[model samples]
Each structure stands twice: as structure tokens, then as C-alpha cells.
Target: MKEKKSMIEEEKEDHLKSTKRIEMEEQLANPDEEPQEVISEKEEY
Candidate 1:
């Protein structure tokens, strides 16, 4: 049970990292746009 819980935790961390990477790529693609993703995430939380 402990191992399964830990796996879930690790997966959550990986998802956050991947989401951040995707946002960064989006910023790169739209260099002229402001970094609004960060602000949006804060609002979501």
C-alpha cells in the first residue's frame, strides 16, 4: 500500500513537471506574448 501511494505521488510530480515544460515551449513559440500561463496557474490554485 505504501509503495502504491508513493508511485501516485511520483506520478503527480511528473505531471507537474511536464505541464511546466509544455508551458515553456508555448512561451517559446509565442515570444511576443507575455508569460500569462504562470499567472493563470496561480489563479487556478
Candidate 2:
């Protein structure tokens, strides 16, 4: 049925969004201790 298919798609989308949120939270919780090295470059017009 069309309704059943739509429900399954919605569930899949919700699961994907949740997983991405969890990954982001984990990264925020444990940040890198080392300072990031940057290479300064002259801006070109």
C-alpha cells in the first residue's frame, strides 16, 4: 500500500538524522587537544 511505503521512508529518514546528531555530539564532547596549525596565505584579488 502507498501508506505503508511512505511510513517506511519516513522512519528511514528519522533514523539517519538521529545517527548524524549522535556523531556530532560525540565530536563536540571530546575535542582535539592540539592546536590546529594554520598556513597563512596571501589573498588573491
Assess every candidate by TM-score.
Answer: 0.68, 0.64
Q: Model 2, residue 17: displacement in angstroms?
A: 0.5
The residue pairs that clash in candidate 1, if any, are: none
lDDT of 1: 0.83
The runs of at least 3 residues in candidate 1 whose Cα sits more than 4 Å from the true structure, single-residue gaps closed, are 35-45
lDDT of 2 by residue, 3-36 (tens): 9999999999999898677656655664652112
**Which lDDT tens digits does candidate 1 get at residues 1-45?**
999999999999999999889778878887876568555866899
What is the lDDT, from 0 to 100, of the residue 44 in candidate 1? 98
Query: How many clashes show up in model 1?
Result: 0
* Candidate 2 displacement at residue 5 in angstroms: 0.6
**lDDT of model 1 at position 45:** 100
